[model samples]
Target: MKEITIDYALRATWQAVARMYNEEAKQFESTMAVGFTLLSIDPKTGTPSTALGPKMGMEATSLSRILKSIEEKGLIERKPNPADGRGVLIHLTDFGLEKRKDSKDVVMRFNEIVKQAVEAEKLQHFFEVTETINKLIADKKIYVKNTTNH
Candidate 1:
């Protein structure tokens, strides 16, 4: 049997969570990406089109595709941005709001179930470990190239 590494564990867990979300979203004729995009947009003020990519940690092309898909489904609309003359803001339509609520409910249920299943201390430790991992990556502590060539 192969030993499990930290990256493998993180990737596997995330894949499972994504698959679960996608399966739930399928009932609404949506995908996980679309639902996530809906949730990311501000419900009231709307979000700048350029900001969505950075906010969601998504690439522009991928975010653009998701935005287009949701727009076609009547889940969102694009409007001229008041703050930026050259930019547009993404707003959720009534249907989008409804779907966002559904997405929120699904996410909340998942968190609630996980909290109920795991001990609080263990959960806190899990959070700490993940945070540390993120910090290390963000700080460029991992994968530093060897200064001396072999």
Candidate 2:
């Protein structure tokens, strides 16, 4: 609509999706962030603490809180990285792996539902638009400094 902006639409849609996931997560006594973090951690080799935040597009403090909660819940454990002595790797517990499977199913179910509801062309366009937005930000082309002397 002419009254709505792209950023607004994106934010609103994401918030709704997050709410949906969180509600579902509540059934398992977990939050969406925890489920997402569970899904992010590799089951076999684990993931570095440093890479987790960037990979998830999460801030350090937010990710830290989520990790702490997950750890307390016995879903994940941190171990010294063999490759890098200074880094810690987050490994999923057996319980964490089970929860991660649940998370993946939930996400896949959402995707399937969306696929059924939306046209393929529209979904393709959505992906293209998102790609363009990401590229613009990555390339620093979304905003430019004013060159003229004020």
Candidate 3:
């Protein structure tokens, strides 16, 4: 591991960002996951409960736990979705809207600072590289299996 790998860099940077967000969320007695969940819900129309997991790239069990916790905190409420009898819509309570604003501000501040520190061209390149990586993985181009046996 003399030379850093792309995955190592991405993982390290993500972990650092997660840690920073969690720390900032602590002031409001919340966690990064909760803040993220709050931001994911539609502020006005509400989001389908089933959609939250996939929308956040999170598993159902983890999202269920977060939803329960936030529900207990009075940040959100689940209501019957009129569009679908069996589906539930997750709506942000008034308190949740306030917290969502805080989360948005925290994220915006991070982006603002990063944009200020990094040159515009470099930042664009960074985004392009990440997008390429995502596309490669999505297309299953990174790891191909050999069918021929030697």
Compose the digit string of candidate 2's lDDT tens values, residues 1-150: 769998999999999999999999999888898889988888899999999999999999999999998899899999999999999999999999999999999999999999999999999999999999999999889797688998
Evaluate residue 73 in candidate 2 and report its C-alpha lDDT on the 0 to 100 scale. 89
User: How would you encode candidate 3's per-residue C-alpha lDDT over 25-97 as one tens digit per residue?
Assistant: 9999999999999999999999999999999999999999999999999999999999999999999999999
Looking at model 3, residue 48 earns an lDDT score of: 100
* Regions more than 4 Å wrong, model 3: 145-150
Ranking by lDDT: 3, 2, 1
- Looking at model 3, residue 8 earns an lDDT score of 95
Q: List the global CA lDDT of all models.
A: 0.94, 0.94, 0.97
Alpha-carbon TM-score of each model against the true structure: 0.93, 0.94, 0.95
Cα error of candidate 1 at position 27, Å: 1.1
Find the candidate with the highest TM-score and give its number: 3
Worst ten-residue run, lDDT, model 1?
28-37
